[model samples]
Target: MTQVVFYILPQSLDNEPEDVSAHFIQACAIAAFYYGQSNKVFIFTDNQQDAFSVDEYLWQFDGDSFVPHNLLGEGPRYGTPVEISWQPPTHPRQILINLSSNVPKFAINFQQIIDFVPASETLKIAARTRYSTYKKMGLTLSTHAVTNDNAVESTKKAED
Candidate 1:
């Protein structure tokens, strides 16, 4: 069964548009660090710009730390631990970190799926819909409300 995790960000919906990318990058980096390079991760975005921005952010996410990643078509398909893509991944059962607005049809194929619920009412409503869809599918689900106070500690723990 797929494990779905919803991470609610500390930022309010008013600031969601501005800080969503940062939140997404931070969450992805932590997951990459925790899962390590052996486990492949796909960070899905809705557009080329978002994909490229995520690719760049992953590179500079941690000043002293790094996550091995590449844009979907930039390099060899298999070796890179993380892939930033606007399309579906070629591999099945990999970790999926979704930054898109809608639920992906291919989401059921992933071993794990992580998504964010921004503080914005509109985004949160969409996230709730996604959560309901996953629940209807009978997937194992979990939620973490991320706050500024615990964000650093959570990242640190994932690093370890």
Candidate 2:
């Protein structure tokens, strides 16, 4: 199964470390839902001792109960796949989810949310939007565009 991994970083690492930590936890919940599996969702932080604390907070949400299998101390490794086993909801709903922040080098994947849509029409719509955004931006079709387009579209709608 394809997996989505998000590298969590503190927003400032200076003034608002706590807020950045809170945002990281919230992002994990969103990531869990996007991946369509809460059970096997894995988060990687900046190899800090406090990283587990953020994971603990994220696991407390309803439908967000997941066990942590820490990979921090595994030592220098390259391209290791994190294991995940998520039971999808019996009846899923179409949701226009958006996650944004004034941070650089952030990414989210569409495969995370694709498993939840049971309808072909909804999937097609998502695909079209994803394609259109990629065409406009001249960037490769990626999960980041699918996730970022929500914010871009919202801004366009607001301006219109």
Candidate 3:
């Protein structure tokens, strides 16, 4: 069964017009965590702009640790260990970091899925639908209350 993890943020920046939201930043952090685990990851975005936003952020996410990634087709044929794209990945990834509004149908292919729930009322409402969908699939579902104070540590140190 696939494991689904929802990271609940302390604040809601889901409606931000720019890509500078905490939600997006946390996604990159989580992606880096998985990359450090030697797990191939696919970061699914809501649009082409979001895909680029993540690809750019990963470049400067951590000054010390680097997560080599590319935007889908622009990278090597099979791509790097981490890939960012608005469309489905051409190859299977061990983990799916979903930054999209609705879950992708191909979500079942991944061994694990990471999602975020901002502290906004609107996003919370939408989260319920996603929760139910995953539950119905009989997937192992869990949630983590994420605060800036403990965000980076739980993901494990990149240098470790």
Candidate 4:
């Protein structure tokens, strides 16, 4: 069964209410941490702009954390350690960092999924729909709370 993990952001980043950059940062951190463990990661964005944003941010997310990644159609045929795309990954990956509004139909192809529940109420509602959909799929699901202070480390901090 696929395992789904949700990282709930406690607050918006940079004091911008409901800012999405926080989600992107956390997703990058998680992808980098998993890549260190030899996991193939795919970041599924909502659109081309978001995919490009993540591709750019992943490069400078941290001075010490380096995640070799490329935007879909720009990377190697099989892709790098991490791949950002507005579409589903062509090949199955070990982990998926979903930054979309709804769960994609190809989500079950991955062994694990990393999703986010933003600080905004409107976003949370959309997240809940995804949560319910996953629950109905009978997948193993878990959630963790992340704060701006620990967002980077929180990826590696998941217990069990």
Which tens-of-lDDT digit does each residue in 91-131 have in candidate 3?
98999998888888999999999887877888877777888
Candidate 2 residue pairs that clash: 34-112
**Which candidate has the highest TM-score of all?**
4
Give lDDT tens digits, candidate 1, residues 64-90: 767777887667756377887889877
lDDT of 4 by residue, 1-160 (tens): 8999999997665443243377887888799899999999999988999998888887766678688999877768888989999987877789989999999999999999999999889989999999999999998999998876777678777746
Q: How do the candidates rank by lDDT, highest first?
A: 4, 3, 1, 2
Q: List runs of model 2 lying over 4 Å from the truth.
A: 1-20, 35-41, 63-160
Candidate 2: worst 10 consecutive residues by lDDT? 95-104
Q: Per-prediction RMSD in angstroms? A: 3.5, 13.9, 3.5, 2.1
Taking all chains together, each candidate's TM-score versus the true structure is 0.84, 0.30, 0.90, 0.92
Using lDDT, give the best candidate's number. 4
Output the TM-score of candidate 2: 0.30
Candidate with the larger lDDT of 2 and 3: 3
For model 3, the stretches where C-alpha displacement exceeds 4 angstroms are 12-19, 156-160
Model 4 ranges off by over 4 Å: 14-20
In candidate 1, position 158 carries an lDDT of 28
